[model samples]
Target: MTFKGVHRLLLLVFMGLALAGCQTEDTPAKPQFVSTTSDSRNSNYFIEFRSRYALSYGHTYVVFGRTDGSGQMINPEVAGLHPKSTSAVPYVIGHFVPVPAETGWSDGDLEEPYRSASWRVMLSQAEYNKVVRKIRDLQANSKFWQAALYNCNAFTGDVARSMGYSVPPIQLRPQEFVTKLREMNEGRRSVSPSRVLTAS
Candidate 1:
């Protein structure tokens, strides 16, 4: 072959290799969970379980059947399921402030102070186990759950989508999902919000 033709061929080969490298770099990396020592983290493998659990309420229900029998003194359903046992009680206390004792109450009566906004039901041991198993399964296979996110619920939906399940129509679009998630994360939205507010 002519020298010029040989040079052109070499240049094309180099260009092809460069393009291939670019394509590889452009592809998204696999998702991973954040490391955490909290019991709540253990419950969901520390991968933004609160949002993931909330988003997958159906799964949550299946895992943690509606009952409180763990004797942990805090209910997962009302307090929010945590991977770590210690974290679970505190989480409930923080979110749902316990009602103070009556003015005449003695020191002994302090143990069972009422919760101002206690959850209606706590998850039984069987239910808690179910939740743990489901979370493990999601961690093992749910890609959306793995992705890093400023908003964890969005990540949960993304994982659901990755699993080939259609996300809720309300969460089909990213913007909508993010908006709803933000409200939930901020504690503005609830299962029963006093007033529904639309995103601007």
Candidate 2:
């Protein structure tokens, strides 16, 4: 009713709008996960921790898939037997690299994940989307991979951490990293072979 009262109300409205804008700017409002499908046969999913000895150091990667046998590797490399390899599976795979060679987190099938320890993880469509989003966010700026700093195993650990799993230290060797994930995955359903797949 009074001029001063009207002025005060206008100020409060301006402040509220400013705060709302800031909140929107600070938040990355991407879809809070992925497709919302509840198909029982397709909903059962798991994360596979894969590793292999390479040039004395070793390599590691992560694979996400369902247990309904819907995903399969097409022309999966037979390891040492192939000069080049790729997968035809619909699963999501993440790879971290070193400099001058596309270093950092990138999406693609790991060339022959020779030995692996895979464990089942129950995730709703939203949770799976969240995990994928986190991986992309973390890997986007991870361009420089250092021996003591960033590497494939480190990438794997970060993905696990993003998904609310306890991860081992990044310094662990590839085999140790897989073992640690397997240990943490204890009691969870597994879609991988009971025996670790070793290179023949």
User: Best by lDDT, which number?
Assistant: 2
Tens-digit lDDT string for candidate 2 (97-165): 123223232332354343433333445565556766765665555554443445566777777666545
Worst 10 residues of 1 by lDDT: 53-62
Query: Each model's number of backbone clashes?
Result: 12, 1
Q: Which candidate leads the pack in TM-score?
A: 2
C-alpha positional error of residue 24 in candidate 2 after TM-score superposition, expressed in Å: 49
Query: Which whole-number lDDT from 0 to 100 does residue 58 have in model 1?
Result: 12
lDDT of each: 0.27, 0.44
TM-score quality measure for candidate 1:
0.22
In model 1, what lDDT does residue 35 have? 22
Off by over 4 Å in 2: 1-44, 65-113, 120-122, 185-200
Per-residue accuracy of model 1 over 40-120 as CA lDDT, tens digit each: 222321112222111111111111222223324222221121222223343233222222111111111112221111111
